[model samples]
Target: MGATDRLDRYQPLVLGLFRIVIGLLFTSEGAATLFGVLDRDATPAGDWPFWYAGVIELVCGLLVLLGVLARAAAFFSSGAMAFAYFTEHQPDGLFPLQNGGLAPALFCWGFLLLVFFGPGSLSLSGVFRRDAAPERRG
Candidate 1:
């Protein structure tokens, strides 16, 4: 097999790594918002959407990282990012650059991908035996 074939064989591992990185980034974002760390101001508790969104990010990010209920968590996370972009970022301008909504837009689409592709080789979902059960194609 050529290098391309070898690379294709490692797709699952690569996917897992991708998921882990995305999850880690998301979790960090939440931590920064909630704890005022990461050189960012903390969202005050009970703040309408920011705080709640932070909580979702923290929880869903961990879930995605762990590969437990990855799809559901990713779906929710994607929605949260979408909501963030529409309500927060899209307001300033239609373009992400103008509104500073790039991060949210990217996160939204990234999580949406997880919703379809699922966690990969490194996920705990397999060990837990609760991973997505694809219908038998026969």
Candidate 2:
């Protein structure tokens, strides 16, 4: 098969994988927030942040699973992990032994990888492939 044909053939597979990963992550996070596994005081200063986070996770997770706006959704997901890592995981120090920091850092790093690599040719993003050739005359 030609390059274009090969890419087209594999596009769905790539997208499906991306969708699965993003869906699972978002669903897991949403479940934690909604179930209060990651609990926090909903105080007067910001009463709804946790709730909003939970809802976003739930909805975005579903969207990612559907391969809708997967890149942007993944970016936000990555941002969430980064925020969590910086705020909660950095207490001990820069290294892994410090305050259970390694896991969060690694998670954030993986998210960043997803954001940058962008699910590759195995995504809905790949399905909407933009040809390199310049526009031609009608």
Candidate 3:
């Protein structure tokens, strides 16, 4: 098979894998921030933005991971990442590398992709989900 054909055939699988990895990483980040379990300091409870962001990351990340309402979760996550980048990093520098905004910027775009493309085949929603029947008009 040609390279393009091979890539096309495996695209869904690769997208699924990518989504899984991204979800796992995002969840890990939240866990680290909220519970201090993964060699990261816990954000103090009631802290402005960080704690709240951790909550979002945990919930949305799980939703994205399981491919349950992933589009919605990704939408929110993307927005949050954009917010984090603009508010926290953009003021420091214009470039992502210079501003320490790489993660947020990448996540924003990545999640935005998910929001549009949807969770690929290897998902809970795909396994047990059924399309609703169309109603007949009288």
Better model by TM-score, 1 or 2?
1
TM-score of 2: 0.57
Best by TM-score: 3
Best by lDDT: 1
The local lDDT score (0 to 100) that residue 80 gets in candidate 2 is 70
Tens digits of per-residue lDDT, candidate 1, 14-102, equal 98998999999999999998999999999999999989998999999999988889999999999999999999999899999999999
Residue-by-residue lDDT tens digits, candidate 2, 69-116: 766777776677677667766765776676686654654565566666
lDDT of 3: 0.90
Against the hidden reference, what TM-scores do the models get?
0.89, 0.57, 0.90
Model 3: per-residue Cα lDDT over 1-138, one tens digit each: 899997899877888887888888888888988999888899999898999889989999988899889999999999999999999999999999999999999999999999998898787787767554455699
lDDT of 1 at 107: 95
For candidate 1, the TM-score is 0.89
Instruction: State the TM-score for model 3.
Output: 0.90
